[model samples]
Structures are given as C-alpha cells and as structure tokens.
Target: MLTLTHRDMLTLKHRDMLAFGHRDMLAFGHMAMLTLTHRDMLTLTQRDMLAFGHMAMLTLRHLDMLTLTHRDMLAFGHMDMLTRTGTC
Candidate 1:
C-alpha cells in the first residue's frame, strides 16, 4: 500500500516533486498532489486538506473509465470550476 507521511507532504511543495509510479493508485496520488500545493496549506489545516483531498479522489474516481484525454479535460475542468467557485 502507498503511505504518505507528513514529511512527504511537506517535501511535495511543487508538482515537479511528485513521483509518477506504475500503479493507478500512485498515479492518482500524483494528480491529488497537483490539486494540492504547499502554499495551499502552509498552515496545514486538516479541514482544508481533507476537503481538497476528498474532491481529488472523487473527481478521479468518476473519471477513471474515460479515455485519458477526456479524463484530463474533465479533471482540469473540475479545477477550473473549483477556482471559479473560490474553492481552490
């Protein structure tokens, strides 16, 4: 199983720091990290973190069956929606 520690979270300050893996779950972790950033939670609030994390999982889960292009579009579209909604 993949485990993410607090220190792991801290080191993943940028998307470039995310490591791509062979497993789907690990790839999802990369996407989640892209959604969440260090500046996003420098104060490290659990509530905010959970909210974003939940959204990332849900968004990816629903898009899992789609083609990569479609999935990418919708995933990024979700991000755009979140931004416009002031949720990001």
Candidate 2:
C-alpha cells in the first residue's frame, strides 16, 4: 500500500472536489474515507460527502426523465468516461 504523502493527499483532495463539482471559495478537506476500493482513496468534505450520497437519490428521481431526456444533454456529462481519452 502506498502511504499518502502531502502532495498525493493534495491531489486526491483536488480530485474529490472536482468530482463533486464543488467550485466554491471554500477550502475543502478530507474528513473521511468512504471506502477502500482497489486501494483508491475515496474521501470527501463534510458537506460534499452528504451531497455525494444524495446523488443516488436524486438520480432515481431524474431516471424517469430518461424517456423524455434529450440525447445531447445525456451524453455531455459522461462523454469522456464513455470514450477512451487516448490513455490506457
């Protein structure tokens, strides 16, 4: 297992913020590790951790929109993940 250096911790912190779209003036910190998945650290802010959880519930409500949803908008969110960005 790779022990987290200050730099690695900082990178992970940045990824967590970017993942949750929390682009505010607040300084976020890792309050907890959600889980240890394949050695990847999944940490979150106090507020964002709650928001991350609420996403599944929100997705359920929005799932119904799939039938009425426009194709362009749906593809926008996951266009990168759906396709390989020239990396392995």
Task: State each model's CA lDDT, in order.
Answer: 0.28, 0.22
Of the candidates shown, which would achieve the greatest lDDT relative to the real structure?
1
The number of clashing residue pairs in model 2 is 0
Backbone clashes, each candidate = 0, 0
lDDT of 1 by residue, 1-88 (tens): 2444332232333322233223222213223433334333221121122222322432222112222211122232333323212322
Which ranges of candidate 2 are over 4 A from the true structure? 1-36, 49-88
Residue 40, model 1: Cα distance from true site in angstroms: 8.6
Q: Candidate 1, residue 67: CA error in Å?
A: 35
